[model samples]
Target: MADYDNSRYTYAQVLAGTGYYMKDDKLRYSAGVKTMQTKLNTAGYDSGTPDGKFGGGTDTAVKSFQRAKSLTVDGKAGKATLTELDKTASGGGNASAEAKNLKKKFGSIISSFASKNSIGEDVLGGFILTESSGSGFVDGALKIRFENHIFLKAVPSASTTFKVEDKVHYYKKNGKWYKTHTGKQTSEYEAFNLAKNISENYAYYSISMGLPQIMGFNHKVTGYDTPKAMFTGFSKSEDKQMEGFCTFIVNYSSGSLLKACQSRDFTKMGQIYNGDGSTYGPKLKANAADYAKA
Candidate 1:
């Protein structure tokens, strides 16, 4: 980063200082935005793009990261926030007691999310099962499936009469999905799901924000109905969402259901049903076996 007068400092300076600029990349804030995105994401904040423009999504993602880390959520990347961010990358150091405290806080966030979203932990379990045993699925698809489960909510048809597809799965891609979990797909469904999940599930605005497009929910969100809390109102923020999702696994997520879902992974998605369990489950497994060329 080139040294310039502080009074004349701009976002460009912030990008340069952060090593996010380059002549080869033209508008270099994208790199800076990526750096910020990685840090914020690691901290459990889900900025939409990490494209390095001072946009609304970035602001919201910053606010969420600040909120999660207990920093002031003014949406401005000030010294304290930047310091914490930098130290976090370097593994947190001699900034102040606040920074050390921030580390502890961040640890708690990961742990909490892990505890709440045991599904995430076990989600790997399910993914591995299908990946290892249910061969013939699209390669690089196992990880994709893992991500799909985190953000989507599978609910039976309103009539509960067992439609062709047992349920329609919905989720937030940016604020809700990416914020809550991890993903990097470029599919149309992925993009649409990303937008829909944010808009429908969390109640954020249904418009583009900054680098990290923090979209609100499109309509309503759906989830399991069990143990009272299992139905909905899972996690709060990035940290808490991870927590809640993990917890849902402990309380309601079923390997059988997951297996069923995995079985259907080879078949057309959204075809597995609830009441037709006896019927669909076997068929799904058979279809997967065929897809595997078994």
Candidate 2:
């Protein structure tokens, strides 16, 4: 397996730059390799979890994927093959510019969140987009991110706009592009839920000249009777507070979530947000389940 710790910095920092996200969803493009997949499968090559992630399993699968398709089986992603891969990714469906818009918006949202929340922009951005969508949600992107969790087979939501009524945080922990994970835990559900609450309700709006939605954030006070005494424009609305919390949620979900998955710590932040990881298994390792993803 190719072990490159460089998946950090280089991954997230790319988010700051526009046009970094894929125009099509990652799974959408990978599905395009069906022809290649069938060929490999016929030749006794294990395509390994056809969820659509181009990972070790996928790479191993690619040798067969490429060989079946009559291409060089070097196993590195390239343009000509990827272009064809994308064409078939949507399963013969067309990827309009609107989808690409979503990818860019998604990236921009994460990048902006890093700047606003003082989080590591590079790390956050890297988590923003993955190999799942052609480019995290860029124009023509076929991949869709439900919350912050990675999924190569992620499909575009019916409504591109974030709806208040949407369940929002129910993440799919299995059946992903790769075979890296297996199941979801209560904590994961909570993290995804809190993250959605923060993203859709708070961070999307609520601004106050850099302070955004903090009352005494710019002040050095020790409980001056009331919050108003320290700062005048503090919003008491829970929605406003949610925005503040959402900034951190994005930061956590985008970075910590990925790390947990890499190091098998998926349940860390979730426990911190849900209850206590010490009580429950610190990490809910992915097993043999439809939800399992790499």
Candidate 3:
């Protein structure tokens, strides 16, 4: 167990930078870690000293906080963790108001884009609800999905290891290979660093960007000249990000998915969009129904 303190820390300090504090291949040392430690300690989570190093104590404290808050309990300070931390630190209310605001702001954007793309607004709304629950930003920026396979492919000659759910897997770190489940949810800065270390191309493809979570590698299919260009453009605003998403769906399915969405054929939509016929299809239908009521 760690020691707890009642020293308050500002939300800004805690949320500054990448807003991540996790134990990966190496312990993280950053102001974000220190701020998180301080916040966790203040909240009676016992994160040990407010040091900038993310070790076992910090990880356990983060997990405890997540468990207490009904979060994912991944022991990672991702967007959700940070948001809950901010709310707790500031004594803010639930996210219902924020969700309502996001939905209101997104209505016009979704309507316009869906109209131009010949899709139904309800379908788009359902997708948004499924993907982000009306929250466009994750930890104060666009969402990021780290792709370790792409990163490793870019370095074809380095020795690397990936751990997933208590399993450690080895990689040659050299030569081109693509493997799934190598990626982890991470902040944009950390994901970007992984990409930069590999190559610009890998950086773009190694992570999905924004609300639609479009992969960087699909920039060409999505009508962007380059992955960097797509990333920069999508990060501008929620509207642009959704537009990029719409464009990707149109291009990827050659407009068939849009037709499916228009007809409320969530089964077809899920098959095309998610690449399988699974529970996602019915879940999407349920989401569509709920959004229609809203």
Candidate 4:
């Protein structure tokens, strides 16, 4: 069983019932809550949608778990309750199985890309592993993340053009109240498709698509004619996703990513690809090493 830690939010924040709750008037979203919800579901406690929001269902589930485990009967997920929850949910099969499954399905494709590009298979494999665990398709649909900020950047007038509603946030800064559009919606493809009706190109450009999770705006670097083309291709086949990934690394930033992969420099790779060398670099390196062993 893997040890789940709250690197993003604190235990105190969770217990105070303010950090991860995203229901009704609350708009906070937490990856920590998502992890807990998944584990709770695995341990036979239903936490409803598992949408990274600690709502009423999650509260009920937590209280039920605490009652059963003889922990404090509060709905809050304190350190002890969380630890026990992890232990209970640890029975859900091998955690590394997903990575292994990725290799099993696309080992040949990874090797082909490595050989064609003169890069290490483990490096490429590790990159994919870090991105999607093995499969680019979730329930037969290409894995996608709709970036609301990117959408707004691409189509600044989408709110008026598409008749989309906005979630306005007004905050005091420098003793003046300013309003900003946080997003149209949170991680919902419906909002993305809605925007696509008015401007298909910008809609496609606003999402990170498929196994590699490359943003649609990078279609040129990935050798696609357009963001829509890349999205269509990636949605159809992981083979095309691998092709796009290989192409992206080779061409991104004038081949710097390729150079990094060639030297097995995950720090540089992470810096170039994810803009974070200190943390994502080590993670990619570890994933590559683990893939090699597996």
Candidate 5:
């Protein structure tokens, strides 16, 4: 795996530093807004003078930039908008050779699935880039950290199902499952143990696993006969994770989402993939464009 720390900065930092989404009204002037105006002007979006003030002209320019980049047309310079701007201002680099190597490793699988589903390779590539940053693991692990509240919500009464001797929790360590007193265990280990225990007692459908974050409950829709099967498959390799993702997409929306991606209709794609009230569509579209360029 690549050792490069390619993770971007936080959204709040981008907004504060870049004047993203700082619109002019009766409010005070902001330096960030002026910086954004200057950057937009440099990029040929034409935000007028760098007055450190936002108005109709700035809004129009922001919207234009968003449209050109296939971002959400909310006319606000949110995290996605600012990130794109930063990339453009810096003359963004293509995907590293390491990234290319990873892509090549999974190329055949992606291609096969794309062909079977009649989806474009670029679309699938973009999806992977956005969803997993082109990696199935993070920090040398399988990206299987536990989410505490989600586990608690999924399995309410642990005593009945887990059958713990006392106030203890189960977890995984070095490929072996172990149990520890409730407060003594880390959340991450507890999440794994809880998921495993739940799958054994109740059903796997309640757990969410792998790159696509597909839930265990949706095993039927995703073509898995059991939750353990889904979890085990995902744990096998990145290729299997991709397989699970493709399966879910193909079964859930019947290729409509893929079609939306091909057409560059991020609004519809986001609604379908992430459900309503999500702003991820534009970001996904932008990331896909970047991956295609690379």
Candidate 6:
């Protein structure tokens, strides 16, 4: 980041910048491209060898990174893409220390948020642990769980687009329609991207995001104008995700859920959050205990 010209990278509201690499450009070699390739590789996008060349592998990697980060899906290493790549690759993938780092970086914010919202601090920690494994991101991008059932119901066109008999995207499980490709970010987003082709708004609205695992349809209670806004904001930082989580806790069901959170009644919290009677109370309690020890 030091040797590279900042003018070449795009930051917020800065449009005079030049792109280091455009999508349609032919195979080219440069130190700038090499640096980007290195970062992309470090960020786990697999841009082939850092040969200082903008080739097909690098292009595909750039597009994958953009897709994961919720940036424009163009395969260009422009201002926004480069900037985010630098930030993401700056740190190593030390997942074992995720909980420690999460607390160390945002302990004050979480404590103050918990106090103000009358929620147990450990309860908040439990939610983060259970929802996102104490990290707001997965594989150098914001964590998301796409719901195919929600997507099918949210967008009428999706029902026709993906038939249950296909046994690929949709499947009937215990008399309920379920998404076959789910439970992992890569597979989930793959399905999500397919759904996005049908209806982008419904696609965004159907996913749960960040450490809080808050669904996009709850944007209004979380103080966002729309589901896309909530997705974008949550993708930027955990602080914004925390803000949305707190706001939603305070506003949802007229603060009754907040009362349950304060009382450490994770059964009620899970019932409200998951929409099923399968209370995650024991797991949440176990997570909180582990975080306390850590």
TM-score of 1: 0.26
- C-alpha local distance difference test of each model: 0.35, 0.33, 0.62, 0.69, 0.61, 0.68
Tens digit per residue, CA lDDT, model 1, 1-294 = 322222233434564453222122133344445566666544434556555544556666666545534687676665566655654332122323333333343335434443444423222222222222221112322112212332233322211211122233334433442222223334423543443434433212222111112112211211333211221232223333333333332333243433434333412221332233332322233222222221
Give model 2's TM-score versus the native structure: 0.21
- Arrange candidates by TM-score, descending: 5, 4, 3, 6, 1, 2
Per residue, candidate 6 scores C-alpha lDDT tens digits across 117-199 of 77777677656655654567888788887776687777766675444454456634345655656666776676667777788
Q: Which residue segments of model 3 deviate by more than 4 Å?
A: 1-102, 138-140, 158-188
Q: Using alpha carbons, what is the TM-score of model 6?
A: 0.54
- TM-scores of the candidates are 0.26, 0.21, 0.55, 0.58, 0.59, 0.54
| Candidate 4 per-residue lDDT over residues 1-294, each given as its tens digit | 222333457544654453432232252566778778887776556778777767677777777677656787766586777776655563354435545777787888888889988989878887877776255776677777676667776777764432323644332334553333343223345556666876889889988887778999999999999999999899879888887887887899999988999999877988998886644665566567556655
Residue 41 miss distance in model 3 (angstroms): 47
Give candidate 2 misplaced runs (Cα > 4 Å).
Answer: 1-59, 62-84, 87-99, 103-108, 116-255, 258-294
lDDT of 2 by residue, 1-294 (tens): 343222222222332332121222233443434344443333234555444333555456544335434567676434444543433232334433433443344545544655665545333332222111222112321111223322111223512322222333333333221211122233333333333444532211121111122222222221234333322222333222223333434434345543443344424633643454432211121110101111
Q: Indicate whether candidate 3 or candidate 4 has the larger lDDT.
A: 4
Off-target runs (Cα >4 Å) in candidate 6 are: 1-101, 138-140, 164-187, 274-279
Shift of residue 16 alpha carbon in model 6, Å:
64
Count the clashes in each prediction. 28, 39, 5, 0, 3, 1
- Top TM-score hit: 5
Error of 3 at 182 (Å): 13
The Cα error of candidate 3 at residue 151, in Å, is 2.2
Report the C-alpha lDDT of model 3 over 1-294, residue by residue, as the tens digit: 323221222335435543444664355356666777776664446678877777787787788678656788787676678876754442223333433454577777777777887777767776776666344466667667665556666665433432122333322234432333344334345546644764767667767787777788889877799988888887788788877776776677677877787787776877887774333554465445445445
Task: Report clash pairs, candidate 6.
Answer: 10-79
